[model samples]
Target: MFITLVTLLEEVKDILKLHGQMLNTLLKNDSMPIMAIPDGVVFPLANVEDVIAMNEKCSDPEFMSAVVAMVGDIGGSSLEDATRRMMKFLMVPELQRHNELAATFNTHSQSCAIKHRQQDTLEVLDLSYNLLEENPALLGGLEKLSTLILDFNNYNSHVKFPYMPSLTALWLNKNKISNLPIIVEEICSKFPNIRFLSMMNNEAAPSYFNGGSLTQYVDYREYVISQIPSLEVLDDTEVQEKERELARKTYRMQRIREGSRKRKELHR
Candidate 1:
């Protein structure tokens, strides 16, 4: 029993020593560069002071958790403070290599210069639930981005999207989009590879769904499909083969009628 107690006491001492070493490393004011640490390593410390201290010691962090930790709870913070803190982290060179980014609920506008060093490597970006005054040029550099979620923003009819060749899926639900024709024209011209698009709950969508009729919904879907030939999924519904054929026929007939009217005007 005495031997067992001695061994247990030694084990406890060793454990305490190891913990002390870890604490020293975390609390140390040494000038160790952050890039020396392996990519994607999480700092186990809590609080903004420790995080900022570590950030100063490290040249770059794998994730923005430390920067976000500085902001505390996002819900309780003001929009300006949240946006400022998030932008500080986003400007980091190491964080730019990350494929996915979520900056939701921050009131950021087009004036915010959200640029990254490795823009081409980014794939998925979510900027939902923000007060975006206009579509920012931050997306202009992200050529390889495929999935972009910008739901519940301040986008209106005059807003224009940057040309993104690799973009496939886009979510613009609950935005202030009103002019369907102009936006559709811009999308058709700019996003040629876009296959999935959602604009549900926008101003233009409800106008088409007057009285909530299924036929009106179909009409809205068909018109959007006609405008954007590359679209396969629209507003969470898949465009069927029959609908595609019908849309094509409708588009061709409309073009023929417009051509006839133009010719008549020219002759007059």
Candidate 2:
């Protein structure tokens, strides 16, 4: 029992040390492999067999419980914190395999800046609180991205993005949007696949749900529903069939006529 406990402690130490190296290197290399070990980390084993073996043993639920039992939890304190970090650190490799990165903050990198090969791997992204006023110069070939969070940005109606056919959800809560039809048309044009959308706290999406007057909220929802035929949820509410039917009856003809007028003006 004593020897087993000592071996477990040693394994935990090695895992944390290697994980620290990986995370530091991953961050510094911008999610790419490091060509050489960075300074300070002394050259060690040439292969990852040791780390893999250690991870497999440490990840066993029974083994984890045994180690924790030996360590003895001390009332939701440092030991728990360290264990939580270890579990999350171990998951980094698995998360990297799927490339489904979410909220990897400080990448303030525009889509054009990321490597082309890595761009399509991104399916979910959170760019919230970035203070962006307009959509960045997003290049083509991001064919897999489906969810985007732009909450707390400074975008207004003039904001625009490259035509993305695969984007299904967008979060634009607490932005600077006052014009309703203009932004709605932009969304329809850009995210032709948008199904879930939120513009809460923007003047354009005013509703009693966020302390806005209830009177015009219905108008807001109806107009948006009329514009985007693919939208399933607006803000926080699911679009009902009855509401959709009413929206179509209310604004479908008006939208068609307006579209016709725009075409005529452009032609002339």
Candidate 3:
């Protein structure tokens, strides 16, 4: 019994050493929080000072137990650059747990700057209020992305949307785009899965500004619904339920016919 107790104690000591090493790594990077929770608990000591203070004040046994339980309930985590003072405070771990991590580059950056590339796991990305003209290629790879908020980013011109199979919501408001019918059409052509869309506040060319009208925009929006005949909403509002259903079905049949015709011509 004595030997068994000694062995267990040594194992516990080694585990504490490992946890200490992990805390040290997080402290040195300054990006992650230095955590000091006891075994079987997770406490994200994020950059928010007030939250830290609250946790410290409530460090009693009961409070610690409750806080540790609440740790896994974090909303989300943010990644920010260490150099920018204003942005450094935006690093909240709650955001990461809730799956809302926004990535923004400083105005001083001449090129489009992206800090994180955990594409397979990321869900929401907000790159608003920047000046990235080239349509950064990093987003093209995030297949699991549900929402993309790029409002106020100065693109100076319209940019293409690459094929994202799982994209449902898109926000590209407050840009200098004069025409985006082709861009929209490409999205409808490639990513027929999108349901929520907001291109408001963009100065689309008068000739291409067609919201309800059929002839103003490019044929891409029509093309998308034809492929994914179950799309329920556009620009966040659900369209006329019955009317849109009929229209989508009709559009799908038209696309099938057109596709078949083109294939026949190629064979000929």
The list of candidate 2 runs beyond 4 A from truth reads 1-108, 111-117, 253-268
lDDT minimum window of 10 residues, candidate 2: 71-80
What are the per-residue Cα lDDT tens digits for candidate 3 across 1-268? Answer: 1121112222222333334422323234434442344554333335345434544545465654443333322212211111121123223446333322223222222222222236677677666544446655567777788888776666644476677878877777666765554656655765667777666556552224434334433243443334445466554346455656565776778779999999999999
Predicted structure with the largest lDDT when compared to the true one: 2
In terms of lDDT, model 2 sits at 0.61
In terms of TM-score, the best-performing candidate is 1
For 28-67, candidate 1 gives per-residue lDDT tens digits of 2223322222344343333434434545434444233343
lDDT of each: 0.58, 0.61, 0.48
lDDT of 3: 0.48
Candidates in descending TM-score order:
1, 2, 3
Looking at model 3, which ten-residue stretch has the lowest summed lDDT? Answer: 77-86
